[model samples]
Target: MKNNFSHFLASLIAVPVGLIFWVLSSNIFDIHLFLDVLVGIGGFGASYLPTQQIFHKKHLDKYKLTNSEYKYIKEQLNQADEQIKRLRSSYMNIRTIKDAKMIYEINRIIKTIISSVEEEPRKFYRGQQFFHSNLESAVNTIEKYLYLYKMPGKSKQERMQLHETRLSLLELKRTLQSNLSHMNASSYDDLDVERELIKRNADRSKKRQALLTNKLDKEKINLKKDQAKEYVYRGDKNGE
Candidate 1:
């Protein structure tokens, strides 16, 4: 209510103040040309735009998420930011180009998602589950890879374990990449709320699939029996 009143009051005063300035400036400069009169009017109108929006925060209106949704997303973004910082601090100690490159790409994706969420929080909120799960997994896998690589390995088993971990981390990175399509912006903002409904539907679908599979298996068995009888009939005819 206060904000609305402030905006209304600003609008009411802006034009009059502009007109006063125009009139005073025009007469003092003895401006009489048509273009000059129009320019004076526009100048005053443009000057008040800043004051008109002074009460609002810039770029906040760009996001369409509800306040609660925004709060949740912002919390996740802060966690991703801290993970990125940790990766950066470990950069100098990264043993391989593969690790360094993967870490860099992880940083890039985190920043990109953060910016997208800030700009259009509602659009990306549908993928909140996908985003949070995959992003945290990626960060943890990377951190584990770094730790294992930095540890000194004297035994053959330790070396083998390090190799296996690297391979697993690579697979984790690929899995994260594959899930990126789901992390993209979507129109639905209530996806987090609808997760339970989605799970129920998925369960029903699996049950239906299982029922279909059983029906098909019975048909296959019956068809095989009929084929066997036909083969016996054909052999009897040949004997005749």
Candidate 2:
């Protein structure tokens, strides 16, 4: 309301100043000579009110979009949840000690994903970084567990289960690696979007600051003009 009132006052003030210029120019020279200039000044002052209001509204909307990054993050979280379910089911069905160890190793990897998702991304450079770090640790642990449980001679069923577990671990590792790569690429894109938004906001602030500075300069010029007119009037009275 205060802003609207100020805009109204500016327009009220500009219209008469424009009319005074029109009158002065008409008296000294031709009425049409300064008519366009007077119209332009008055029109600009009137239009500025709506323009400034629109700009302020836009800035407010931009600041409200901080959660836009959550869309991509949520998809990654869902994938992690699915992986956890698969690992948990596999762990429950293990009969042999070797099979149990293999399932335990897989569970460790899934747990890493869960922990990564639970941690705040704002605390890290990117969400992928946390996942990747934990993934390396999980893989190392899995390799160590496999080496400890190696049997030189094994029965057919045990050998088959070992092969299946190895295959599953390899597949899981591939999936984790692919997901991490894609996530890193997407993080770069996200950073670009954020950077562009910051640049736009900075540009807007600069423009608003410039407009305010120009308005202050104009007021100062008007004050000097009024002082000059007073001095001229006083000198004329003394001469008379």
TM-score of each: 0.48, 0.33
Report every candidate's CA lDDT: 0.66, 0.58
lDDT (Cα) of model 2: 0.58
Candidate 2 on 12-102: residue-level lDDT in tens? 6656766665666667656575575666566656666565556545433443323444445555566556545644544444456865765
lDDT of 1 by residue, 21-67 (tens): 67766777667666556766776677556666653332234454444
- For model 2, what is the alpha-carbon lDDT of residue 112? 53
Error of 1 at 146 (Å): 1.5
Once superposed on the true structure, which residue ranges of model 1 sit more than 4 Å away at CA?
1-62, 185-240
Q: Poorest 10 consecutive residues of model 1 by lDDT?
A: 55-64
